[model samples]
Target: MHTTLLKDFSVSAAIAGFVTVLVGFTSSAVIVFQAAQAFDASPAEIGSWMGALGLGMGLTCIVLSLRYRVPVVTAWSTPGAAMLITTATGVPMEEAIGAFLISAVLITLCGFSGWFERAINRIPMSIAAGMLAGVLLRFGLDVFISMQTQFVMTFSMFCIYLIMRRFSPRYAVVTALILGILIAGSQGLLQIDTVRLQLAEPVLTTPRFSLSALIGVALPLFVVTMASQNVPGVAVIRASGYTVPISPLIGWTGATTLVLAPFGAFALNLAAITAAICMGREAHEDPARRYVAAIAAGVFYLIIGLFGGTVGSIFAAFPQELVLAIAGLALLGTIGNGLLTALIQEKEREPALITFLVTASGITLFSIGSAFWGLVAGGLAIAISQVKR
Candidate 1:
């Protein structure tokens, strides 16, 4: 498998892996920290969570991709982390861990029972694509919105991306990352001092279950992860024309999460936008060989896990504008693909558009995210249209 990855290796695939981790950690590591803080986790406990998550993601990405020979990248549930930022407060650390365990168990059951996979498969391709696009729309727009503050750096990165896209589309994101870093460095935007060299040790917290925490934290986390993260992840895989079984993957993630919950593995699931970096044509000319990109990402993830504290600092040192710019540039192709796919079926177009717009609105009601509502809205639209017909 190592030999296969080496033999099929391309610079594009390597860059894609680096870009995937860069975007993944940069965009959401802070949210994960906030989630940990909400549960009143000590510094050591919080660091442990980062380490556990990185290790889980690393192992899963490598194992799944190598075993299946597909680009089966996994990620810490970013949206789940975001949901935790708001919902975790007032929940005791022990109870939070209990909630995590419950959520993981539920996810595992859903995967093993095939209910989650079946329900996900029932979503039309247009609606799935619309949901994905809606989820990513903010990051895409942030590329431009960032220009207002860091005009020179963002503009330079954008120009470099354009130039690279024209000449070597596969490495455009790589070029943008490099240019963003260089520009940020030149402008003294990085906090190099904060990034100390160190390894992170995991701190386990005992779990204490509560019905309130189960319903408030566990159920909501489960729903947010499924609707906001896993759904888009499956959509990305299907859109990329991969035949990987979603149920087993989800089950494995849930199982992994369950084991590591005491150490802060909140949720681990398939990646959507970041996985696209590995699955894209740029990663490898032969779709079958693109698993190498995922493996590469796993390698980086392992490094991040082993040195969790340092890795967190490194990603933190990157300027917000730089991170946003690179993330947006990397996701441009994905966003375009999603929009194109969502609009392909004439009959489904309206509902899909509604889904897209609602998701893009970033609405939150009853502490549930817009992705769930968008799906509901689109499903309702489809049912109403069918009744009218």
Candidate 2:
């Protein structure tokens, strides 16, 4: 893997990126769509986002891996997309676009200046592990919690997944997704009418730069996305024992986001949970070959951009429970490992567990997501415990 990327390409590497693409796009594409809805994005605007994000992620990953000679991957800003649901609302789309650009600039600054790396150095390994666990735990719980209302639909899918995992673990997630769709359609749990088959045409919105949008949406978003998401995202790569260039990777993602902001690309950041899966041994035994997986992901993302509405509709077709169950199963290993890592140390264990539990509890305070507060509370716990000593 370290020697050179092209040198590592194998038949196995070729499919790694494709598998990554399906996992990423299928897993949380709907949530991203819902987030766009909160910002009052039209279908075209949403598709543009999907398109630009695909283009940015694809171009960057493909370029950087070949250029840098590493299995480097760039992901659309998942946390930033997550933020739009609650924070990007009421702001004009143009201002949000401006925010996207501004945030990209900041991200670039972080990379060029090496400030992010410097700051990351200060974080205790245990705390970083805890935060990673905490962040992923939210999605982990969402997987099952979603089933509370849709049990029959979810349970059947779970059973199919179990059977597949026993027989063919490699295709378990994909098979489960397929079975979920079939069962959902049969049960009448799938909703197909809302799907618009038209190709997504990019609507150019003249960006309206506002200090207010920068102050409200852009700054906090850049902070949370970088600190909460990218920080852990990078950690996942390092933790998985991959040593790639951090600064260049950040710069590439930031630059890509800057280019696509005109088309409503909100944020582009490294993926933590999902990227780890692709980078880890599970994706391929040979580390040198994982770039192929990222390439596959890029190709799939391009396809998503081409048929944004149709692809979006297909994901929406399955009963919601099926998606939830699949996500839970796919992420279960990462979640459990993260929690175990977070609590392994004696001093940090309690605080880390508090972080995980509070984050998992889904208690939102003062309009802020629990992901942030979990960090705050855990940090406070660590601080106070330190002071007592």
Best model number under lDDT: 1
Task: Output the lDDT of residue 87, model 2.
Answer: 77
Q: Write down the lDDT that model 1 would get.
A: 0.87
Worst 10 residues of 1 by lDDT: 365-374
Error of 2 at 365 (Å): 5.5
Enumerate residue pairs that collide in model 2. Answer: 16-293, 17-293, 17-294, 17-296, 17-297, 18-296
lDDT for model 2: 0.70
For model 1, the stretches where C-alpha displacement exceeds 4 angstroms are 87-90
User: Candidate 2 has what TM-score?
Assistant: 0.79
TM-scores for the candidates = 0.93, 0.79
What shift in Å separates residue 111 of candidate 1 from its native position after superposition? 0.8
**Local accuracy of candidate 1 as per-residue lDDT tens digits, 171-220:** 77777888888889988999998988878898889999999999889998
